[model samples]
Target: MLLSDLSLSRRLERAERDSNARFVEARAAVSPDVGAGWIDVGGTYAMFDGVESPCTQTFGFGLFTAPSSGDLDTIERFYAQRSAPVFHEVSPIADPAHLELLASRGYRPIEFTSVLYRSLDGDLAIAAPADSVARPFQGRVRIVDADEVERWAQTSAAGWSDVPGVGPFLVDLMRVAAVRPDARLFLAEIGGRAVAAGALTIDDGVALLAGASTIPDARHRGAQLALLSARLAYASQHGCDLAMMGALPGSGSQRNAERNGFRIAYTRTKWQLSAGTRA
Candidate 1:
């Protein structure tokens, strides 16, 4: 049983931070024009995928120790050098002093995420969709091979194309995710047609579950549940002890995670340097 304490925060924060670091590396490798990169400040990861990319942020701060005023200055300079806005995904369990420093730096809260976790024990359960499928079809999930990276990216992009904006950005990000080192892209199919896509990456015995999306047409099917079960099974087989993901508080994703036995580890805040203070 993992306690929701600093120890747990370290594992979860490290897992996510490393995942984004790998993503930045992958983006640079696949599309150098994007100028993707990252650096380690104190113990935090400062990543730059692009000026407008959500991957442009810092992670894992206050995990090993609190970030000093100088550390924040260095981090701000890292982003300033790239002409990008500064953002930090801060866990609630982070040292109080870190929050104080952020306040002093004129950062303001802009987003909230419910970080969730579930231990991977024996015989994991595969859930069925909340609503029965409109059409009867068998669901299957499998990890894509290297040759299918583009296919995986396309399927994942198709899943999010309906979002009001960020379609093009997500398309590129999905492409980068598909090729990240040590990352596994999974696809769910029904009647020989791919309907959903997701990604799994592990770091220090913890698995980060992300990029989950089902194409608009396949919404009522069991593709997501199948993908979730398959990813969990793979994580367990590969020696992961804990699995985690973040979702907007009170969103369908959070409810779905809760139904799958994941409990809220903490509510994290995404702090951004106020527009007036940006370099």
Candidate 2:
């Protein structure tokens, strides 16, 4: 495979594994009044919900493609019973029919994102901020430990407030990080106060970066660079040959990934269908 394709595959693999792990963690924490189900319908799979409010269940294919009518109906039913908003994650390779299906049912197209990848096999380097921005950040980066889970979760919530399902989503993320040594959470501290946080999940030969955020007050202060530098270095030393991150369309996060050596391999869109909507 080409380097970029290899990187993308590795990234998708890491995402799938981490997502599955997150689901298991979330299921374990499900409230007594909530219910959850995992369904595999041929090529399409879904994490279904009989859950409480403020939680979302996702439906999509393991490998992006069009679903058969029967498979689509299964997906529809899975969401219908829950009465909650349902989301479908679509990659560039998603079947055109799937998009048509969602549109016909009023499942508006929401966010568009680019998947970026960087090959670590070569001499991968990231530029440091100017001395003015870099000097004050020295020795201020630290990894989030058990005691800092709540703080990290709060930081994530504040950073991703516009994203749906964030509160429960981040709580579940931190819960997994708490027990998984392979999951690294890095924070940038300024004057002994944590101001930014990011996470790295290493699986196979790929290291996927996720949940990167900096406090509004901390922007342009080298906090993000510090966290990224720390994670990349750690990944390199541990034998990872690729780094990947998802970028929201036209967002600064996308710009940062490009500036740091990651190249856009492909774009993906998230399609939504409400539970009660027609299939």
Highest TM-score among the candidates is held by which one? 1
- Candidate 2, residue 98: the lDDT equals 67
Clash list (residue pairs), candidate 2: none
- Candidate 2 total steric clashes: 0
Tens digits of lDDT, candidate 2, 1-279: 345453354356446445544554455454334555556665445664344422244424434444566776777777677664666665655455766666776777777768887777766566653333434454477777778877876775556555676667666555544445556778788778777888887777778887787767667877888888888888898888887888776777777778778888777666766445666
Worst 10 residues of 1 by lDDT: 128-137
Give RMSD (Å) of candidate 1 vs. truth: 1.8
Cα lDDT tens digits for candidate 1, 1-279: 778999899889999999999989998998899898998988889999999899999998777777787788888898888899999999989887878888878998999999999999865885554755434336789999889988888899899878888677778888889888789999999877889999999999899999999999888767888889899999999999899999999998898888888999999999999977853
lDDT of each: 0.88, 0.65
- Assess the local accuracy of residue 175 in candidate 1 as a C-alpha lDDT between 0 and 100: 86
Clash count of each predicted structure? 0, 0
**For candidate 2, what is the TM-score?**
0.77
Superposed model 2: Cα runs more than 4 Å off: 1-24, 30-33, 48-66, 101-106, 128-136, 158-182, 274-276
